[model samples]
Target: MDFQHLSYFIEVVRHASFSKAAQILHITQPTLSKIIKNLEDELEVILFNRTTRYIQLTDDGEIFLKFAHLTLSMADDLQVSLNDGKLLKKGKLSLGLPPVIGVSFFPHIIAKFRDLYPGIHLHLIEEGGKIVEQLLRDAKIDLGVVVLPVDERHFDFIPLVERQLSLIVNSNHTLAKQEIVHLSELRNESFILFKEGFSLNDRVREACIREGFEPVISYESSQWDLISEMVGVGLGIALLPETVLGRIHTESVKVIPKTVPQISWDLAVIWSKHHYLSHPARGWIQFIREWVWLQRSMI
Candidate 1:
């Protein structure tokens, strides 16, 4: 008998009622009863004992039930093997990334991923680095990009990128002409920083505190350009990665070398240390590692 008829027989036996099995399988009771009848006819034996109040398996039916269960289980394993293809031909992955990092890095990689595994659907969730880390811990996303020096104990990661940060100030600001600026030099300067959920914000504040003073907070925003614009008008100075500088109007703000323990924005792709990655997620991790290796070798 075909798998369809066998599965119907198994479901009918599982519930011990044609009506219940049909409801569970979304088929009609008559259709289920007919299939069971055809299976018994093919086997030349009675499969069910029917009464007004109860439906019970016959002696022969009980014996066939064991084999039926095994067959169905094997079918299930085969289905899983087919669907969860080793090449990531069919699956879904939910990945989290900081907005700036995602905007900078994923465009090419994502397009290439689509070309390689057309059946796999990729869902990207954008948020701040701290929020992305929280999402990873909470299992909201399968994988994420987080800033470095995070709680290493809870994550397994691969280093992504490291970019130098510069001191950004109004072109007319006093330190604008300085070749190299110190973190402590900005101790008294008003700061325009990122909002609370950004790792960069924590890093900036902590650096200031380490330099022996709290940053004088003048403004906070989620967007670096907003921080840059505020700095442009002499609102305050801010620290930003060199990559972001290209996107802003260069003339609006002056960038000076930052050297009091040079600030570098280091990032990594991370996943929960204890979480079991699905085939799709594992495939993504492999792809990222290989891509990173190739990029490095080229350099």
Candidate 2:
């Protein structure tokens, strides 16, 4: 029940050796062992099974680990929130962004943010939307920019932009000369697409289904550049967001407006309503919202 005991128990589990845990915790091995034993006694459960050379979690310990992690995370957040004013000039802000946004927008924004708040440390992580969502839920990131359709119950989101999706093919491909192509006309054509769980891939599949057939997928990749390169080789055509298309430098590929209903994905800034945002985090969020709005208006 005591935080110190829980901390020691977690360290022991993490290292699987009391001596190593003690070394990491800057405590004696016997002290660390006593803490774990005390934690087990307080909880009325055996937390670990020990041998001369090894330590392993008991079934109860495995379950306890999950709660322990959550408890410690909450405690850390509380401390951070309470100390926010004192830490305002020296705190760290962590952000998560999907690949397209990271490549296209983050550089200038990050540079400006750092210039304005030189004392604040900024950490940005680039990942797929699913990973960014997980990081937000776990409180690993203060803010995340992700393609929309996230679980609205857990996050507060502000729509930044709607990215138009376009059908792209090799410039020399037969379809490239057409200003527009019906979705149904590509029913038999092989498609290079984003991997499963990506918003783009889902949109592409849904569009194809609306046209009366599932697409013939020839390749799937998470990287837009690779998808563009594959499409350039005449392997298959792809449906990608306009933002991603802007990043493509491959000369072989060309965008073709879809004749069917235009498809687009909304990009949003997402944050946990339950998590406390630090001063710097709040500032950066506002800056991002405003910057995105300005860019949208210009476009």
Q: What lDDT score belongs to each candidate, Candidate 1 first?
A: 0.85, 0.82
Residue-wise C-alpha lDDT for candidate 1, range 224-273, written one tens digit per residue: 88888999988999998776777777686998866587877888889999
Tens-digit per-residue lDDT, 244-295, candidate 2: 6777887798888665777777888889988888888888777877887888
Superposition TM-score, candidate 1 onto the true structure: 0.74
lDDT of 2 at 84: 62
Looking at candidate 2, what is the lDDT of residue 236?
95
Lowest lDDT 10-residue stretch of candidate 1: 97-106
Model 1: how far is 285 from its true place, Å? 0.7
TM-score to true structure, per model: 0.74, 0.66
